[model samples]
Target chain A: MSPLSITSRTLAAALGGYGLASLSAMALAVTLPMARDQAVIIGIMVALLLCSGAAIWAFSARSAWRAWAGILAPGVLLGGLYLWGLPA
Target chain B: MNKSFRQSMAWLHTWTGLLLGWLLVAIFITGTSAYFREEITLWMQPEVHDSTLQPGTIDMALAALNAKAPDARSWDISLPGPRQTAAELRWQPAKPPEDGRRHRGEQILMDADSGEVVAPRATRGGNFFYRFHFELYGIDRLWARLLVCLATMFMLIAIISGVITHKKIFKDFFTFRPGKGQRSWLDAHNATAVLALPYHFMITYSGLLLFMTLIMPWGIDAAYENDRRSFFSEVFSRGEDAAQPGSPGEMVAIGPLIEQTETRFGKPVERIQITNPNRDNAQITLRVNRDPAVTDRQRGGDPTQVFQGNTGELIDTHIPANDPVSPGWRIYNFFTSVHMTRFADPLTRWLFFLFGVAGSAMTVTGMLLWVSKRTQQLRRDQQPDRALKMVNGLNMASITGLMLAIAAYFLANRLLPVTLAAREDREIQVFFIVWLVSLVHGLLRPNRHGWIEQVAAASLLWFAIPVVNIFTTASHLFTPLAWQHAAIASFDLVCLILAALGGHTLWRLQRKPLPAKARRAPAPRPFNTTNPASEQPAGESP
Candidate 1:
């Protein structure tokens, strides 16, 4: 793939991941406050840190797969946290 | 200097910008208006005009509050001063055992002298615009905030890539060559982006940081274990817990407290918070700080001091200039100040306003750049491709459509039935609905027609705003001008001028017919050009 396409895809993926992390973090912040649930809040915070790291990596990395993985990890992890740990 | 890198950056700039250009337009418009939030509030409420400034002591205000709301849990009084006409009072009723959210509160606008509630109407004043930028109406606030963050991210990339794409950033700093098609658009985008680079950077970064809790709450969550009050107190040194009463007795008079607060702060008291006003545990916390010049210097830092309720003792004072707290605090304050323009003098505010206009222009020109480049390419290829056509349509809707939607918001503010459910929200609904309608219209119409029609419609709506205000309400340009409310009057005139500018733009674009050469196929060279008889005279070719 062309460098431009790679960069665009990487940026889009990073944004998608950041979106999920932010949504999960927000859910935790709101729901945790009401439920007095600390564990879920911590879980979301850990997911956010991972997402921030992925964004940084995606921004700096040259390899396409590495950039894609860097961008995708946060979204996948947040999804897992929401599905398993969070109440519907 | 690398051609490929430049090409890649150009591609990055174009797409990144296009993806978020409409959102950025809304942010720029709303953000710019937010600078004049107080002025807008002044304009909205015509009933409270130039009231007498109250000189009564804080003790008198506290006495009034105690009499009015004896059983209230917390009472807040905004002292009547120069900028504000009425002494505003707020108090929370006893919270029910069921939920904290059901606590009843009242915002009383007092007669500066008698301290009686007068002209009490629930109206979203200038604060609406200020809050609207981050918290868009209808949708979840978190969603709106997240969208703004995403836009800011795209904006940062666009600005960086835009600088790299510009070959003559310095040389074309002041250059503006109108009627030069793509060159003019590029020059416009470059000039605005470069001239206000610092403003753009500071505003976008600060906007992100303003909601840093939402964006990056991990640090606060981990450190304070997600306890909001503790997190705020630790970072701001606010000291959340109030002092317990030493001995249960009648509270001391607020007049002496006011005197002590004024003597210590050397500024007029702006607000006073009373805890347990009627009870023996009552404490009046007088906040003395309201010099915009000095407060602006503090950036986003709280420049006020809190005093003990009973003894009038100093509790806590925050002087942002005296010491640097945390790096986070300083950064947060700097950005917040930039966003709020609280530090801005009139001239500086105007400069920020002008730069805001330039920022809006940059987004419009960027969209135009895409359309202009694609049109040129399609003309060269001798066919209008489907992708190019769709882009052209989107450019029309995104640019002019946004202007129309903003105008629609103003119109809705005036025309919507006052009794409508969630009236303030209805104005925002009109804004989005109008914009969506324009988008759908653009999709249906021919690209050329869409541009002309949407711009014309926007111009009309914009021009109609002041006229509507004049007819619908007592506050018009004439009255405000007569009263020497320059801020309010000038705001209306500025809108008119913008409308006129939009009209002129639409007129020019509509007048220029599509070039015939752009539509027709290129002529083939004569086959028998080498034969002298067959070849016509150079200028006489059929």
Candidate 2:
């Protein structure tokens, strides 16, 4: 099977992209020095934009593995940092 | 695997559009209708056709409420305004039952003049179409919302990719040739799309934005520790008040409070809510019905004002979102206003509805174009494929069949007995059953017969609505319609227009049968695949 088949791209975008967006939103919410309500609101907008970009990138990428890596690497880093010592 | 940007975008556009186009069409149609949902709901309930808004209506309503729910804890009176024909009144007891489905009170419609109960039909108001627009029926709210969001995202992707693929699309807007088979469809698709390009983009993006928090609430969940209410309180400043246990105090006249509220705000009041009525802790809250500004700031503008119930003295008031709003609330409200069109005037509402219909037409035409192209290919290589057959049937089912189902739904509302329990749910059930039957009808024929039959049925039903309304209710198309109650006449007119349009299209389809040009050779070969199936690939010409 081709590495950049539509099916693989879909999986990477939906799963990996979703994880990245979710993790980044949490990280921003915790780290931003603004009020929590403001931080969360801004974080959500950022996450949505990031998610849309990831989806577009997933389909446009030459290989599906790169799509997965592009999303999951940042996702895991933020997720790990969140787990370590991020404020609620 | 290797393709140019435009080619890749073309591929994405076709797939994404095909994958979610049916649902998109459904959403567009229902949502567009929801823009006129108030009119549709009024048409459905003919009981309040004569109850026009007049002077002294507020005083009458106040007297009615004071007499009806004297000992009640709270009184909420929504005076008749745009989209509403009657003064909607509700009151709550000090000790209320735990019923979340309905509002927290015994609700009833009060006539503006006499303050008599205007018992309209028990059907779900314009709320049905509005709710169905986002959260479709027969599903959990969360699940329905998520499904709609997913489809919306796919539609966004399709729109973006489509723009990329159609580089000279602007030129196509000015180019259209009638009577040419594929050219006509392309022209139609391009014309409708390009004409309402901005509206389509705005509506689609705002639709996605409307459900942003529900779609991406991780940040909110984390910040508020999964408590959504706290975030809501902080962002949207709801009028938080407490009721005290005090002895019964001399109640002040509501007419004075109403006068004071209107005078104080320099705007017409739409509703008033009295918490702890007739008690020392009573508070009167007045809501502005219409924003004086040409354009509304937020979805429901903060034109809410609270007054001391006993003294009729103003306590607090909130203006529109001009005040400081929490982080993303402004953007959220902007998108919401665009999507909901709640702030739109009648003319703007009509434009939105028309654009929505045009968008639906574009989707339907695109689907038909796809089928026609495939049919040509099938004729060139004559072997019946299951997928092509299924697509043909599904298109007929969703496009025209849904219209038939909506018509049937209206007919059911009039025919069903008012005394029947769960009549609203049953009416919805009738709608789905009729839709399901039409789908079966589509699968059975999938040709000229299917198209003609379903469109004809829908047209007849559209015509029959006004006829039935005249016979069953007081309102009709040709009757003398007053300006205040013009919605009823307008409803009838809209139906007549739909009937004429449907009839004209059906007549044209029957006269020409455009599909004949596309599927001349593959017309009757769906069932007979023995001899022709053998020599299928022999004459394959690209």
Candidate 3:
């Protein structure tokens, strides 16, 4: 792999993965019907797992672009959920 | 496709394990020592070693507190259990001074048996290690915690990728081929990692969870609308001390309350918190030793009995097992509590400590395996590159050099004059200085000589601790008082045990042939070193 490709994939794994995890946390926190505290905890816990999974996906993907796409797709979905669930 | 996936995972595991691996090793060692935090604190304060468990220890502690701070707003007495010898007495003054400066309440260590004040030397004790475990010393607290959280994330990823990369995890658990350089290190690494796989996973994941609020606050921010404090209040539910101080009045006897709470909980009371003491509305809350089996919420779940202090009337009772916790909170509490070993008995704490040792061994072997593998692949005539040499020196400093530094820290605790100003900071300085010296030593002599010398020096320092204790403090290894105080005795014994281990390692290193014989010939082809398939044995592929 080229140095540029590795660096791009690393950024995708770190920043993109963190972005995806944060989105998941926000989406679950707002959408889950449970109490806010419990929802927040469950969201963060699952988000951490998703972060690791994103890291693995970033490395295993055939191309760095695919890595970003894989992480961003779910992130976009979670962002939508978060926005829809937000209180006016 | 399967093979490629495994190879990529192997690649991921190697880098993730190597990058922050040194920091992870230091974190693991200190964090493991924190399991004995109270005991280490006890050992450091030799002035209280004679304060063994006695009947009516709580009564004496109360008497001391009442004499010291009779009109204080609150009185807290932490009675010594198995891991401590001193009754820690803390009292919050009635109010802030007229100048409105924050009044940090005064604390003093009293002999649990005698109730006489004991002034031990001023040192950070185990708190240094405990605080350094998460928020490292001498750095901004936020940055230190953030760095630690990042290393923890890397650890979580490393563990996951490592499992994916290992083709025969169970089979490798049973294998330990001795005397082959890289192969032996690999075997040790596999054995330790697989043996404590669950523990490693729990510790790393829970480590991240412990700092989840700081690291992953998005959920809380979204749900609570950026009100982090409200989220904590909701989760922890620490009710405000509502009752104001009433007129000064006689308080109830604490002895009966202690016995009553112990009988009710089937465990000895660990602490007594008296709010609005000597007032009409004085409240006494008795908390007993935590039962490890209880997987309740970490905060506010101890089995407690509250009494109207002046009236001696039972106000409320809390049995943690009877309390209902949400499933998510229960899971969170279980992992974080286990990681802290907060409720563990001595035996269980020891088991966790051993598991921590195994975790440390896993990282050490993994680091060694990396160096050994690269060294083995080195061409016979080609010298090691600068990066390899740098990593080798760092490995020495982080592993054995760190051992030497801790020994120096303990030695500084003993050697530094008890009356010296800023004594605790001085001890910490000694630790860092010795560690820095070892780093230079490692870089200068990153070879067989450096390992032998540093290991020998650490071993000597550890061995010297008990011997020096006899001359410096009354609670030496041979003293009867040492036996009476289990914490002090165990601390010295652990030192000796570690010293022996270091000695054994030194002996093994000496017996082994020099570096030349350890190195293998270059691989048959000019193998692409970056290829994961070329790194390990190829027989696993189907």
Question: Native-contact fraction for each model?
Answer: 0.00, 0.46, 0.81
Output the number of the lDDT-best candidate: 3
Error of 3 at B537 (Å): 20
Interface RMSD, in order shown: 8.9, 2.3, 2.1
For candidate 3, give the lDDT: 0.85
Candidate 1, Cα interface RMSD: 8.9
In order, what DockQ does each candidate have? 0.07, 0.50, 0.69
- Write candidate 3's Cα lDDT for B1-542 as tens digits: 23487888888889998899999999998988999888888888888888866787778888888898888888888888787778889888777566665456779998877779989999999999999989988899999999999999999999999998898999988998766566777889999999999999999999999999889999999999999999988887877854778998999888888889999989888889999988888999999866665367777778899999987889999888887789888889888989988778888999999999999999988888877677657555466677777787888888988889999999899999999999999999999999999999988777667778899999999999998998999998899999887778888999999999999888877775454432345544243333222222101101
Query: What lDDT tens digits, residue by residue, belong to model 1 across residues B1-542?
Result: 12365665676677878888877877787778777777666655545544444566344566767677767777888876534556777887645345555545766666666655566223465576577677766689889889888788678667766776777888888898666566666677788888888888777766766666777775345434557776554444544444443444466666666776678778766787777655666666666654454223332343556555556666667654565444433444556777777667777888888888888888877777776655444323255566666666676666778779878877776676656777766766777899889988876763565666787898899899888878766657767431454665766787799799988887677566544443345653232222221111001101
lDDT of 2 at B354: 89
Candidate 3 TM-score restricted to chain A: 0.96
Flag the better candidate by TM-score, 1 or 2.
Answer: 2
Model 1 regions lying over 4 Å from their true place:
A1-88, B1-3, B50-52, B56-67, B80-84, B96-99, B102-104, B111-129, B218-232, B243-264, B290-324, B380-383, B417-421, B480-485, B510-518, B521-542
User: Which is better, 1 or 3, measured by DockQ?
Assistant: 3
**What's the distance in Å from true for residue B439, model 1?**
2.1
True contacts reproduced, candidate 2: 0.46
Best by TM-score: 3
